[model samples]
Target: MDKIRNFCIIAHIDHGKSTLADRLLEHTQTVADRDMQDQLLDSMDLERERGITIKSHAIQMNYRNGGDEYVLNLIDTPGHVDFSYEVSRSIAACEGALLIVDASQGIEAQTISNLYLAMENDLTIIPVLNKIDLPGASPEEVSDEIVDLLGVERDEIIRASGKTGQGVDDILDAIVKRIPAPKGDPEAPLQAMIFDSQYNPFRGVEVIFRVFNGTFKKGDAVKFVNTGRTYNADEIGILKLEQEPQKEIAAGNVGYLISGIKNAREVKVGDTITHVERPCEAVTGFEDVKPMVFAGIYPVDTTEYEELRASMEKLQLNDASLVWEPETSAALGFGFRCGFLGMLHLEIIQERLEREFDMTVITTVPSVQYKAVMTDESIKWVNAPSEMPEPNKCSHIEEPYIKAQIISKSDYIGPIISLCMDKRGILKNQVYLTTDRVELTFDLPLAEIVFDFFDKLKTISRGYASLDYELTGFRQSNMVKLDMMLNGEKVDALSAIVHRDKAYEWGKRLCEKLKELLPRQMFEIAVQASIGTKIIARETVKAMRKNVLAKCYGGDISRKRKLLEKQKKGKKRMRQVGNVEIPQEAFMAVLKLD
Candidate 1:
């Protein structure tokens, strides 16, 4: 067998992992003479738009060193914490990993988490300090930090500017020497881990995996160990890291399979692929992925509910991490309660659902996990806005908490700490970096920071702040489940459980924002805030009286009357409480801060 090296590149957000991959492909002459697409691993438009690696991509290249040819199977993993589970799965498929750290920014929280994951997997780690050509390039400091924090030897850090292609060859050389070749029995029973998958209308379910042991050629019958579903592999191909596909792939290689399996639900990530006749035991280390954040996703037009469902189903086929179930709302009609890894993942999914599927979505307010203790002595987990029990119905409640790390310039330390404190953040530790930058660690409730913490941090620090957080756990605390009422009628979709101290402030803010965003209708609208049965605050939206008064002067009275009728019909479609027509924008207004 050829000397093959299977390794994944891990990094924090904006650490140049994809850029470095492009550089590697260019240096290896993997790109064809006429092919010219930047960030080739970012195949999807959504991936490029977000500037995040949503999908983990694998590519193969031939490297010649000392007149010896070696094959490199390089996998690029997502840098965001939302896709951390996917990152772990991708790492498990590789024999080694390239821990790419930003030269100036040093190691981030996600970077550390990814490093710990690689260590746990026992993968050979090749430390690479990327972006060495930037104005603030500090390879020496980053190198020292790597040695100090990651326990890597000082001499092991590979310095490279993925942006300028400087010192890239050195990185490649280190990869060849530091990362070990994949070691598995090619003759053993066929076994592979399904790290990622997708659905193509022409090819059906495209299952991408790294063969751990044994391999089979085309026409091999394989069984998914977890699902017990069998399929005949009609074709197998490896991504050349360019635009074309290779004919065959083997053990220690990353590739995709066309098994004619149309159902994407059957082919799940972490599922073991094995030969049907002689299947190997399922691989260990796979864990059930639980989505930490959820939002009610609905079609902007109620008629497109089926289309939205189809789109979500299609998306879920390849993205096993995405969770969705049927959900309904009086305001949004029928939709899905989509669960995501985190806020970023939720945004990406919503954006893709609209852009890729050409369907407008009405997303409900994002909700974090809540632990409810019932008066009947029952424990339950609640995530939906409509599911939060009334304050009087609960004996006790707890909100999910997270451990957050904020790195900022020393000058902005006061503002950052103040912002965190206002959100009920408790400082766990603090460290100074150099003389001007400081890193503050806090144990804060996820509910507090989920809304606009990052935005506020940017505003306060003038975009000099970088933050990272991980879900710590839950803490028992006094909390109240607050509800929104429109003209004394409770809106289940607008309810939330907040800390008792901040309830009035949040309620007033939400009601005022909703009134501002909700356009005036044919009748007066009242936005009310409620705690249990008592109303705390209210805002009035005056009825639109002269919306079509200008049209009468144009001598298009029929058109004017039609427009008014359409407006009246649109007003009728809205949720009416007393005299108010609550627009969809009113519901969305709660997301923004005053």
Candidate 2:
């Protein structure tokens, strides 16, 4: 136990956490140079392409110096706010965390949030200043900021360049010296924390856990504390680049357990695994992850409903945070209403379903849960506009709000604040990080930012602004559900939540955008936006009339004129009763308004 060190690397996205992990992986010779890949901890291609970590990955390493040998268990976690749950689970598995801050960008919105998270977990945090090799690298300036933020001495902070392998040895030494060894009693009954899991087609459910006490052998029958279920361990092993089987995983060690259970629901992250014969009490566990964003996912072809369900179940095996249920939409055929941690999480699942499962899906506009106070003194929580109670039936509606922190240049503060104000954001505070860069904090509505806030914030700040947000609570507001109607038919997918004051402008703009996107029809199509009984804006799509005079002969001009008049009359009659076929893209036009 004294020779083991379990730790994780935490940082803001693009702040070089993965790069630092790469340098450390090579420094310890965990994997050889030929086999090593850049940002090796990011196992998914999507993660590398997006330049961010979406999932947490773990690896065990063996290091030797002089006469001392050490076991280091390193976990790399996603830095984005959407994956905060993953970060928490990663932190829980480790005794310490390495806080990596970029020398150029310094601390960011996510940096502060991650700092608080580390503090909450009571883990030893080693502050490391990374990317000293960059041209604009300012170690002194960023060092001062870290000192101010973390109250750590300048000398205590280690300076390293992940790209050049500088200070790699010093960091490894600090881990052995600073991070205390994992503490547990090998004689105690079995106890372990399941930090991560995966569904293996060949091996059943493989779970990554840290042994808190006792010993686990290959054939031990372990019981899950949360579910009260027992499974015979088919195999036990440790992960480096791949699984290496072991005779036993001792106390205070991190490894994998091949729980020979085909069903994913039998095990879960944050659940405790104990020996069935001599089980110990479960440790205080993590809080349940509540999804903040909701969306309706319907199959492009409804006949593939069962296939979609199976695909979702497979995905849920790995992503326990995902929650979904069978739902039927009047317009979208059969589908499921899925909940996600945030917008990024929702997008990732949608993309993976389409690409990995070979199923085409139509996702509705994302929504936030709103609390409604009914006229009968009752309260209800709604996730979709269709679930909202009638305006007359409610005394008031309360929408979810978020505490958003932004970091950007001072020159762009004016426009950034203006954008926030437009989104019904209340400025809470602002502080100068540097002479040029500033941090702005606001309390904004969750619905406001769920759609296009991040993209718009980037545009407003000229791609220099970064954002972090968390749901604060619900606040009473004058909210309305704006609906769009095409040819007197309500398109449920085009509904949105908006403040009443912006209803006219929002309605007018949506109608205009829809008019440009919807194809011309055989008859006139009326695109109208409304709130309850009031029509706020309307756009008329003229009938696409066929020329009645195209086949007319040179003679009998009067006959051709009569044919044109008849055609006009027929078009006018058809315009009154014919249905307009709006394409799928038209229903998604509101998403482009950003």
Candidate 3:
């Protein structure tokens, strides 16, 4: 156990975490030269194309130092704020963390938040200045920032470039010297915590876990404490580029377990796995995932509903942060209301469903969860606008609010502040991190940032700003449910809960956007945006006219009138019975509304 060191890499987005990881793997000879590639730990095609890590990857390495062999378990984590929960879980399974900071960018909002999380877990922090090979790299400036953020000595901070493999040996040496080895008793009862999982169609669900105590052997009878289900361990192994099967994995090691459990819900992340005969106490579990965004996902064809549900179940096994339940919409038919960490997470899930499962789905407009208090003091959680009660029956509505932390150049502070204020943000505080860099704090509605706020911030800041936010509890707000009506029927899929002040303007913009996306029909279509009894905005899609007088060019006046009357009646009848086929583009129009 003294030669075993477990640690994870944590950083802000695009800070060279994965690149550094590749260099480490190469130096340790953990992966063969023929197998090595950039961002090697990022196994997903979506991750590689987008240049982001959507999932946490765990791998083991064997490194020798001064005649002594050492085992290193490195878990690479996502840098995006949406996957912070993944980082948290990775942090929990390790004894130390490598805090990587981009030399040119210095410290950003996500870096600070992830640092705090590491501190809370009491993990040893090793500060490393990455990307020093960049022409814009400011190693000295970034070194000082890391010192101030972590309060570590100047000499302790390692300057390395993940691209050119500089200082890779030093990083390995530091891990062996600085990070403490995992401490556990092999004699104790089996107690391993499942940190991550993925589904295998041929075998079953594969569970990746970190063993804190006892031993797990192949063919051992194991049980999940949370689910109270037992199964024979079909195979046990340590995670590598490929899962290397082992007869047994002892305490203080990270490995995988397969028991032919076909059901996804049978293996829960953070649940304790123990031997059935001599089970240990269930270990304390990690906090539950708190999804920031809620949206409905439905099959394009109603007949594929069961297939969609099956696909979601398999996907959830891979992404434990995703949550969902069955729901129905008047316009979109039966669907599932799925919860996600943020809009980016929602998009990735939707795309993965299409690419991996070949499941075509329609995602409704995203919204934040709100609490509605009734006149009788009953509290109800409203995840969708359709769930909101009537204004008279509800005492007040409490919407989710977040404490937003933004780090950016001081030059763009004015525009940033204006954008936040426009989103109903209240400036809480501001501080100067350096001569030109500033950190601003604001209290804003979660719903405000659910749409184009991130895109606008990136545009205004010239991609120099980084944001991280946490829920600060619900607050009473003047909220109203804005409904969109096509013709005369209210489309529940397009409903949104908005602040009273912005409802009218938002409704107007949305109505206009729908008008542009919805195709013209044979009959006139009325696009109306309303709040309860009041019609806030409206637009008309005129009916396509085919001249009935073309056949009667020189007919009598009575004959022409009769043709016109017949056309009018036909249009009215068509309008009454015809169902508008809302194109998929129209469902996502709210996201593009300017």
Which candidate leads the pack in TM-score?
3
Give a tens-digit lDDT track for model 3, residues 1-594: 898999999999999999999999999999999998999999999999999999999999999999999999999999999999999999989999999999999999999999999999899999999999899999998888888888999999998999899989989999999999999998899999999999999999999999999988999999999999999999999988999999999899999998898988787889999999999998884898999999999999999999999899999989989999999998889999999999899999999999999999999999999999999999999998889999999999999999999999999999999999999999999999999999999999999999889989999999999999999999999999999999989999998999999999999999898888889999999999999989999999889999989888775899999989999999999999987889999889887788
**Prediction RMSDs, each to the true structure:** 5.5, 2.0, 1.0
lDDT (C-alpha, whole model) for all candidates:
0.81, 0.88, 0.94
* Clashing residue pairs found in predicted model 3: none
On a 0 to 100 scale, what is the lDDT of residue 513 in model 2?
A: 89
Candidate 2 per-residue C-alpha lDDT over 130-193 given as tens digits, one digit per residue, 9 for 90 to 100: 9999999999999999999999888989999999999988899899999999999999999999
Tell me the lDDT of candidate 2: 0.88
Q: Give the poorly placed runs of model 1, Cα more than 4 Å off.
A: 242-248, 433-435, 545-581
Candidate 2 clash pair list = none
Instruction: By TM-score, rank the candidates, best first.
Output: 3, 2, 1
Cα error, residue 443 of model 2, in Å, equals: 1.5
lDDT for 21 in candidate 1 is 92
The TM-score that candidate 2 achieves is 0.95
Worst ten in a row by lDDT for model 2? 585-594
Worst lDDT run of 10 residues, candidate 1, spans 572-581
- Over the stretch 1-594, how does candidate 1's per-residue lDDT look in tens digits? 457888899998889999999889999998884684777888889888778898888888989988888888888999877788778888888878999998888877678788888999999888888988889988887787788776878878888888789878987888788778777788989988888887788878888888888986778888999999888988787868532445555677778888888665677788899998888999888776788778888887888888888788888865678888898887667888888887778778887887878888877888888899989989888888677776667888888898888877889988888999999999989898667767899989988876777789879999777777778788888877678877567776777778889999989998888877776766667788888777888998776665656646767568777888977776655535334456677666667655
